[model samples]
Target: MIKLLIADDSALMRKLLQDIFVAEGDFDIRLARNGAEALDLVRSFDPQVITLDVQMPDMDGLTCLSQIMIEMPRPVVMVSSLTAEGAEETLEAIELGAVDFVAKPSGAVSLEIDRLRPVLVEKVRAASKARIRRTLRLTERVRHQMRSAVTARVRPKPARRRPVSGAGKPKQKPGPSALPGLVLIGSSTGGPAALDAVLPSLPGDFPWPVLVAQHLPASFTGPFARRLNSECQLSVVEVGNPMPLQAGTIYIARGDADVVVAARATGIIAMPAPARASYLWHPSVERMVLSALECIDAERMLGVMLTGMGNDGAAAMKKLSEGGGRTIAEAESTAVVWGMPGELVKNGGAGLVRPVDDIAEAIVELVGAHASH
Candidate 1:
């Protein structure tokens, strides 16, 4: 059984969350009234997965989450409201090491909470599979430091990472003309922070139009793009209404539906994800890759898979590789879940595997040669 903990200030909310998980019948659940209680229970219950409220009286969720990560690294999913403030705090929580988040339903005591049940259950299961890393966690002090740097538009010096074995660095160097015609990426679980890390590394004038598909809720994707645009060199936009593609700007797939790329007389058009294209995750990675491949010859394409929970993009990435595209996957050492990229590696889909920190530099050097032109 998955040992689970539900921490919230509201008694009703706590009970509602617990009942949602209890129906799963595979979790041993524990409840805490606030951050302080959550901390207390952590020592005793030792939950495999934790659901945290973004706001809790006495001790807020963010503070408690940092402490949990620093003291004992386990999977955490934020249970936040659907408001704007809730979205911002939840994104911060993800960057801080919480696996993922689910928004609270419409009202105080509405049965609408049941709508979030699948999301809650899936996030917990994914968290249970996380590597449970506890080393060099971002303390509250570091978070403040990073924020101060962001406000000044000055990039903070990132923490140093030690190299791990088995992850093969790119064997072939990116020559002067090694840049691809297009770049496609897909991720889930730990993707928000991973994208934050990668996008900032490229130059403001990157050549190819980078398209990305991530498993995220519709409410969060727009805010995520806005947040990324503030910190990264490249401009980020969420695909909502149909528009032609452009280089130097990153287009993120809409979380509400699939984003299909099609070749049109006017360059490329972004299409709404059709119901006919059934998939496990919204903005499915495989569907994106397949569509791109059908519409464009991928000989000069590049596919990169970041930290995520499943094999949504593996097969398509493999086909991309076979069809003569450069492909890379985040090494297991840095991936939070490693499911998507790991599947690629196992199937010999990735030509290169590097740590999360190195992916951007690799892209900059590999695609930069062409992107700069």
Candidate 2:
């Protein structure tokens, strides 16, 4: 039996979680009513996977998570609310080494959390397979990747030369706008924190716009974009409707649907995801990449597959690559779950494999080369 721990402040919530997992029939469930109890049980139960609630009395989930990672790093799946604060903290948990998160379906005390039963079970299963690393080792690897990226050759800025005036004077102005085309990136599971590592590395003058479609709930995506915008130099916004694409901006798809790119005589436009049964992830990575191929030439686009569960973008990325598109897969060394990118690499879709911190450099190289042509 797979040893599992369920920790929450509410007795009702603990029993509720227990009942849900009990139905799965493969887990040996243990319960903790508070963080202190969870800490004690960590040694007694030695759970293989832990489902930890975000808010708890005495010691909160974040604090408990920090301690857990330090003393006994094990796979953790956060139970978070579908609210701004919850999303923010959940992302932090991922950065802290949690395998993934589950959105606690709308209610403080309602049984509606049961609505997440299917996803919760699957995530727990996935979490069990996660490789738990010590905090020091993980941090060092991330720093190394970032350092390597900075030292690597990347996108070249357009030459800036002053224009000669009527006489002998010269006038200075901002550099020319970034080249045409788009960069599409997709991820799930560990995506939030991975995105934070990558996006901030791309400068404000990054050539071509970026389109992102991560697996997120409607309530979380908006706040996620806002949070990303605060950290990254690029202007980030949550896509609401069809809008003209512009340079140096990153548009994140609405959580409930896909964001598709369509070519118009005027320019490229972003629209809501169309209904497609083939997709499993909400803002389906495959659907978005395929739709983007219609507007941006495959040879000019860069398709990046980041950490996530399943092969959401693998087939489409392979297709994109066959048509001369540049592709990258997040390296397993850094991936929280390498399923998506691992599939892509297995299918020969990616030309390069990089860690999350090094992806911005890869993007710059591909886009800059494409632009120079």
Candidate 3:
């Protein structure tokens, strides 16, 4: 049975969540009246997943999260009110190692409870299985110290061109049947499972380089990449500084960094920014798509918007479409949350709407068809 600890100050909210989970019939539930009680239960009960309310009487959820993550790490889903401050704090909770969350509904208990059931169940499942990592603040100082030590031990090398793969083969003008130069994909929320379904279907020697941005907590992205690499045929690695893009390899953006694909004379540059502040979401899909557009012209680029909550990628997909690039948005039935890709389709940004299973094949065919012209 999945063990869950529901911590909230409001008795009704806690009871509602418990009812939702219990109705699902697969959970062992524990309730905490406040953050302090939750902490005590976390120590004794050792629950696999925790749902914490942001505002609490004794200790706030953020403080509880900091302590829990440091002492005994586990997946935490922040139960936040649907207020601006609540949203901001919930985002912070995500940054601080909470896996994900659901916005608490207001008014009409029956209706709100019904509306939240699906999201709550899904998030609880994802959180239960998520591999929780150490909070970034605790590790940042150590990481900084380690970085300084490493920098002192190593010497910078001169910039050299990375050789393009499969270059030695005789130039065969890729007839309209060849794949494009690069494939750029952006996703959030339910992206990992979607990508897992889509990526492994492509052949091992897939012709185009694949770049992806999956909105995720920094702590989760490393494990997420490992999980994808284990399941997929293609070699997947978390994109780091100065990593050169290579065909047949998939580069996943590390959380907390904006992933931008820049073209160079030798090969593609995987540009990562450590402190990008302008965008609301790190690894912003808009930034990634715009950068890809700069590197590969629209016709040679393929943009994909997958399931997510917000409209982060919609604007950029529009730019890509206007630039003559083909864009695909995940269909509603296939999406866990239809907010992101749904916006793209509604706004006329997407050139095609396809199921998750057909995305890779569609890209291959679309690029191949273009190459033949």
Candidate 4:
């Protein structure tokens, strides 16, 4: 049985969560009413995975999370609200070494709690297997805190470049039918921090437009894009409407929907479409890659699979490789959960396998070389 800890200030929430997990029959669970109690249980219970509520009284969730990461360094899943403030706090929790988060339905005690049961159980199970690299977590926490200290007052710059037309596109393509090479990225679970490592490393003048399909909630994606924009040299925007895909931009797929590219008379554009029941994960990587393939030739595309819980992008990327596209899978050495990228590697899809820190450089080298030819 997996040893689990549940931390929340609300007696109702604690009891509901306990009941949900208790029904599962696989977890030997303990509950704490506040962060202070949670911290104590961390030492005494030594749980394998923890579900931490961000709004806890007495030592708040973020403070407790920091201490836990510094001292114990185990996988933690944050339980957060769906509001904007909740989004910001959840992002910070990821930076502080929490593996993933589940957004609570609106209201203090929601009727939607029952609806959250499946997702909650699934994320906790995934967290149990996640790798918590203490060195990497500590390094990122320090770096992020220092950066946050300096940027506390300044607002993130708005995305400046407008969509580019086909006429304005570079002349490096093989034919009129082929578009400039695109970098398609897919990630989940530990993706936020993994992306923090890669996207900020690329120069502002990166040659290709990058599209990222990260599994997130709608409220969180906007904040996530803004956060990435603040940190990255490249402009980042969440795809909420049909926007022209331009070079040097990173477009994040809106949460709760899938982002797909289509050929416009003027240029390629990305738009958020209704989530398809066929794909299990929202902002589905499999669907995104398949959609892009319909318009862009395989050789002119690159597929990057990052740390995620499931094999969403593997099959589609395998198809991309079989058609001559370049692919990179994050190495197990650096992945918090190696499920997505590991499937890509196992099935002979990846052209290169790299650690999280090395992925940005590899992308620059490969895409830059292709554009030069």
lDDT of all predictions:
0.78, 0.79, 0.74, 0.87
TM-score on alpha carbons, each prediction: 0.83, 0.83, 0.57, 0.90
lDDT by residue (119-204, candidate 1, tens digit) is 77877888887864333245643466446546863545453232222132222222233224778989998888788768766665
Q: Show how many residue pairs clash in every candidate, following the order shown.
A: 1, 1, 4, 0
Q: Candidate 3: which stretches are off by over 4 Å?
A: 1-180
lDDT per residue as tens, model 2, 216-238: 88878888887776666667889
Worst 10 residues of 4 by lDDT: 162-171
lDDT of 3 by residue, 30-140 (tens): 999998999999999999999999999879897788778667878888887656566556644654567677677877766788988987897788668654432124344
What TM-score number comes out for model 2?
0.83
Q: Model 1 off-target regions past 4 Å?
A: 20-26, 107-115, 132-137, 140-142, 145-180, 274-277, 368-373
Leading candidate by TM-score: 4
Point out where model 4 deviates above 4 Å: 107-110, 135-179
Q: What value does the lDDT take at residue 91 in candidate 2? A: 66
Model 2 scores a C-alpha lDDT of 0.79
Name every residue pair that clashes in candidate 1: 258-273
Ranking by lDDT: 4, 2, 1, 3
Stretches of candidate 2 off by over 4 Å are 107-114, 132-179
